[model samples]
Target: MSRVCELTGKGPMSGNTISHANNKTRRRFLPNLNEVTLMSDALGQSFKLRISAAALRSVDHRGGLDGYLAKAKDDELSSNALKIKKEIAKAQAAA
Candidate 1:
């Protein structure tokens, strides 16, 4: 799988590593991604996703997976996450 967050779309960045002698070397700054299985109350199921640490914290801050998916922007989420967001919205609308 790619090094990208499923929810937040966080990806690796390119940068230079400087040494004491002012030598620069190209390096990739990878996001802190974790494969997590989060339970969705609205869907009544648990799904596995590869998300960044920051996204994980934001999900917790937003009050769980459902809340995060509902509030997150479409551009910030992966295709699968967008689908989940739609499901959550539909479930909410029907309730």
Candidate 2:
């Protein structure tokens, strides 16, 4: 799997590593990602997603997986996450 956050779309960023001699070297700054299992009450299932720490915090702030998916921008989410978002929406509409 790619090093990308499923929820926040955080990915590896390129930057320069500067030395004390003012020499610069190419480097990659990777996002702080963790594999987390989030449960969906509506679907009665759990999803394992590789998400950034920031995204995880935001999900908690939003009140859980459902709330985060409901409020997240579709463009920002991964294809898998987008599918879950659609399902959540359908479940909510039905409820």
Candidate 3:
């Protein structure tokens, strides 16, 4: 699987690794991705997602999966996450 955050769309960033010898080499800064199951309060279901640690904190800060998806940009979300977002929206709207 690709090393990307499903929630935040975080990917590896290109950078340089500087050494003590004043040498620089190309390097990649990868996001800290973890597989976690987050529960949606609105949908009352748990969804497994590959997300960064920072995104996890943001989710908790926002409240939960439903709250996080509410403020998330469509472009930043993965297909699965987008589907969940839509379902949550539909459910909340029905209620």
Ranking by TM-score: 3, 1, 2
Least accurate 10 contiguous residues by lDDT in model 1: 83-92
Q: What C-alpha lDDT, on a 0 to 100 scale, does residue 62 get in candidate 3?
A: 95
Query: Candidate 1: misplaced stretches above 4 Å?
Result: none
Report the C-alpha lDDT of model 2 over 1-95, residue by residue, as the tens digit.
89999998999999999999999999999999999999988888899999999999999999889999998998989999999999988998899
Per residue, candidate 3 scores C-alpha lDDT tens digits across 1-95 of 99999989999999899999979999999999999999998888899999999999999999989999999999999999999999999999999
For each candidate in turn, the TM-score is 0.95, 0.95, 0.97
- Please write out the lDDT profile of model 1 over residues 42-69, one tens digit for every residue: 8798889999988999999999999999
Candidate 3 residue runs with Cα over 4 Å from true position: none
TM-score leader: 3
Clashing pairs in 2: none
Stretches > 4 Å off in candidate 2: none
Q: Which candidate number has the best lDDT?
A: 3
